[model samples]
Target chain A: MSNKEFEQQLQRSVAQLTKEIQPQRDLWPGIEHALNHEQDSQPKSNSWAFQSMAAAFLMIGLFGWLGFNQMQGGDRTEQLVTVLSEPYQQQKQRLLASYANQPALTDNWQQQVQELDDAAAAIKLALKEEPDNPALLKMLKQVYQQQIDLIERVHAPAWQTI
Target chain B: MQTQGQLVDAQEHFAERAVLNLIEAVKAGDKQAYQMLYQQHLGQVYALCYRLTADRALAEDVTQEVFIQLWRKLDNFRGEAKFRTWLHSVTSNVCVSYLRKQRGWWQRMFNLENSEAMHEVAPGSAGEVDLDSLVQRLPERARMVFVLHAIEGYRHEEIAQIMDMAVGSSKAQFHRAKQLLSEWMGYEQ
Candidate 1:
């Protein structure tokens, strides 16, 4: 054949081969089965997807529940701290009230006694504000005799430890 | 606009009722329509696949996958582009993704005698075309362009989009394909 006709023949051949390589007729049954099974198998796949989604949602809900409880626990601790501090504040006020009630005398002996009582009350108030404070209580005990001496001169002369 | 062009356009387009019917049947879970549609359009899709993979079995597998995916996604088909065009796009995309996954398969499959390459052909009264030598010799990208655009009737723009190349590149590839075949057969310039 002439080259021009040969080229045309080649193009024709190429086009012909394109048509012949279709999927085999035998595989069509398998292909059909595949399609039918595809129809049959879809519900199972959907069920799996739904189950996974539900599991995910359940886990999320569990975490949310735990987190909410943890936040509530933190709030409870804050409230307890506030409640526990109130009594210390009240005790400090009571100590100040008692000190205010004591009167001063004209003599230095009474004045010295009143000063000691004032110091003791102040120390006690400080101790109540910080209930675990041992330093202030220790200081208060060191000067306990001064108040006792004044009180004994006025009333019980034989009281020794004050 | 042009009266003569309008007449030619009218001649090229056919009522797409068969495609629509098959789509409806497949949507209704009719396996018969699925098979008929497969039989009717398998050549075009298979040709597209073979050109992309250059391996017959892989092409067959991709063809199967394309049909499977078509069945699965049948409900998503709206009447946008022509059904055949949409099928081509889907087939081409699936072939590309398959190529990415099966690089080793491609290397091994094409490693044999170059004479065994699959050829793109048209339906005819004759039983088969002698394609082993012609297809074995054409450059890969050129053969794909020729098969997609010339034999399969895809426009250059469509081939470019499907193959992810520039439109100019598809045009150039097609021209080079025609030129190469003509030279291989010793045709006149």
Candidate 2:
């Protein structure tokens, strides 16, 4: 057969074949059913991955908020502690500095003796106000011993050289 | 011929619009549009499943599953390629998985019809030629390549990408399928 005839034959065969294999109308119902089934089964927010992600996000957010609140609370607590404790720190510093220059024996230690007298007077007043408190009594005793030690030590002669 | 062209064109336009409509409806969980969309593409999807699995029941099952998946993934369809191509790709993947799960060579090759069953079906075309039977007779790879390239009108490159074969292999398969078809038709060299 000629090339033209052969080409025609080939085209005819293809055309006929395409028509013959075209899917039946009845098959569409099953196909549609499959499509619906597949659509139903696809991954959605209902799936485990999505649920897990949402749960993780919620947990992280809760922890983050808690941490933020605690951080703010800590800052406030530190500020209050500092404000309440500042005067006590200052009083302690004055007491400590006044004793720095006292010697074992001094000709006239009147200034050193006066500072100790004032501190002891302040402690006595505070103890009278809070009479039953052991902490207050303990502090009062510490101040008394410190004053007596300062005076006694100053009255003693300078340390003897070995 | 003109009517067929008109019908195909109308179907194409309808399919495009229907898909867009389905996208909106599916997002809103509209069952009606989903059904409409499924009806529109069912044949193509099932044909793909049937071709890949070679089992009517399995193809039906896979087709069902594929459509459900397609509905859920409608948002993911970026309109980059034709929706049909996306559908076919999904169908092919589902069939591959089913075949793998079945783990039998015969199942992989599709239920080869017994001679008696084959004889029962009348040829719809002249000269006792039934395209489906002829397609079924092709080697798995060659048949897949043929259906994708010739019937489905996919390019060799696209077929290669979809089938995970080299482009040359796809082209060779197409060439082999054409030659075989020509032989089946008893076309003289």
Candidate 3:
């Protein structure tokens, strides 16, 4: 059992080894689901960039008009903000729904997330009163980004030591 | 379940034209083309991941991750590198990132006592055992180096870059891996 002979024997054994090992399960289904999920998650138009810009302008104008009236003291900012942001709300809802059942990484992640959701709710409540506040819109976007980051981190791939 | 290396080496690189065509279609957002590529590469990718991670389910999971990444980043493939080479690079990065994310405190704690850790020995006679099973029994860093060096044909310097270790470390780990495999084979005899 000299080192040289051992090395030669190990080399021979490895040379005979198969480099391709088939998975026991049909991995195609999982891959298919992921591909489809990605397609579903993305905005579904080549013109979405222009469309989103146009939509954003329209929303800003509408919210600005509502806020102006509220300053003059009218009361429909609630309904208007909801109408303007309906699409984004649906997108967020769908995002939340997809990962709803995934396990969280930290024990306090849910509570931390709950605090973010509460902030989001409070921001929406304020938007209903003063819908055109740029600061508020920016805050809402940040909250959304945080939620997405949190969920993605929780579901991130890890080494399967097992 | 042919290896991608076999595909690359076959007949002046088998299916180079077909793979190029698939890449074109994939760049155009063809899901079918992507799936075709996935099927062609899954076994090799899974085997690579398994050797790196030493777990079947994780190998499959990482294989799926590799494809998902390929689909997302297919537009960045400029045909400068061979698709197989590009793919192995991507799989290597995906495995590296996977290892990084698993360094969470709780996971490290759990793995210390985890019964199902990669060191689990399957019940079988040594002669009946597969090379992959034996490779998985090597220590983690050694297993990664052996697969990247021996099976994947990476030079120690290249493995150093991929695994982010010194070249000598890669060489040493590879030798350690071979020695472990030798011991296992001697036991079988």
Q: Count backbone overlaps in model 2.
A: 12
- Candidate 3's error at A111, in angstroms? 20
Question: What DockQ results do all the predictions give, each relative to the true complex?
Answer: 0.15, 0.05, 0.22
Give one digit per residue, the lDDT tens place, for model 2 in B146-187. 877766667889778777789999999877766665555555
Superposed by TM-score, candidate 3 places the C-alpha of residue A12 at a distance from the truth, in angstroms, of: 1.9
Off by over 4 Å in 2: A1-10, A13-162, B1-15, B80-82, B96-128
> Taking chain A by itself, what TM-score does each prediction score?
0.27, 0.29, 0.41
Q: Pick the TM-score winner.
A: 3
- The residue-by-residue lDDT of candidate 3 on A48-135, one tens digit each, is 3345466567778877777676643223645554644575555446545766775433345566567767867887877767755756
Each prediction's fraction of true contacts recovered: 0.42, 0.14, 0.53
Per-model CA lDDT versus the true structure? 0.58, 0.55, 0.66
**Which residue pairs collide, candidate 1?**
A14-B120, A15-B121, A15-B122, A16-B121, A16-B122, A17-B121, A18-B120, A18-B121, A19-B121
lDDT of model 3, residue A128: 69
* lDDT at A94, model 2: 50
What's the TM-score of every candidate structure? 0.46, 0.48, 0.59
RMSD of each: 36.5, 36.6, 12.7
Best-to-worst ranking by TM-score: 3, 2, 1
